[model samples]
Target: MAVTRWIAVAASVLSLGTLFVAPPDAPMKKTDAFLDAETTGVLGIEATECFDDPAYSRMANDRVVIYRPCEESADNQAFGFVYAPDGAFDRPAVAALGWDRCGAAFGKLWRGGSAEGLDFYPVLPTAETWADGDRALMCVVYRPGGKLPGSVLPLAN
Candidate 1:
């Protein structure tokens, strides 16, 4: 299957489900380091390579890419992001809006036909993060059983 098709599927999956309506634990600060740590945890990896993109350069948003050496059981090239600047990350409605924004971003990528074999989910900011001046709605992406050959930026264009 083409990679863009998989991205489309991932975007659809994100819209169709409600995996996290609220933070499961105590609210944590959503800092750059914290976002990277969260992304690493979501991708189930020890470390990741990340950079900033003008596409997501509004507010306090950030984007992260996951690259691993490679394993037969898992192909590990994927990317995710937390976007926007707003208050009230702890509110369920706010989290829902973040999810919607994330889905919209992925939908654009899918329409451009430059993505493949991906899965994604959104992460909500907590009150702590909000209090600390974090207003990002995050989406983390990964491939279920395949790895991406390169960065997702070109595909986004």
Candidate 2:
């Protein structure tokens, strides 16, 4: 399935509140490092670090996103955050919004250079979190193959 379709389907499923059940231990705290990560900090995520699958998956599930410094490899490299408009958690819509935002940011970052091997994706919020007032969309840039060695941001010549 296309990424947008998959995101829509996942959003629909999560809206139903059924796939993942919270563990019976302590209630998850919002202050967890992942949950409390600021946009500035997230923007620093690069080839130096990456988000594991569990963390990347949680991005759409309204859960804290765990990240680790890239040792040998990683799933995705976070590069920035997009401020999604305040509204219901509509995955496809938010994804589009995020893409638009990321596109502009990417243009500024790359100065119109070709992003031939790189692609951008958004980590959007779940309906529950939307209702509870989460409006940030994490944006990431990654190569199709796998892990990167250093920051993806283009440097001045």
Tens-digit lDDT string for candidate 1 (96-135): 6655776676676555444455644455555665676756
- RMSD of each candidate relative to the true structure: 17.7, 16.5
Candidate 2's residue-wise lDDT over 1-157, tens digit each? 6999999998998887764777555322121123223332343344335765444344455443356565545555666777777656676787678778877876776565467566666666666667777787766666665554545667667
Lowest lDDT sum, 10 consecutive residues, model 1, at: 46-55
Model 2 — which ten-residue stretch has the worst lDDT?
A: 27-36
Q: lDDT of each structure?
A: 0.47, 0.59
In model 2, what lDDT does residue 70 have?
Answer: 53
**Following a full C-alpha superposition, what root-mean-square deviation does model 1 have from the true structure?**
17.7
Per-model TM-score, in order, reads 0.43, 0.54
Q: Which numbered prediction scores highest in lDDT against the true structure?
A: 2
For candidate 1, give the lDDT. Answer: 0.47
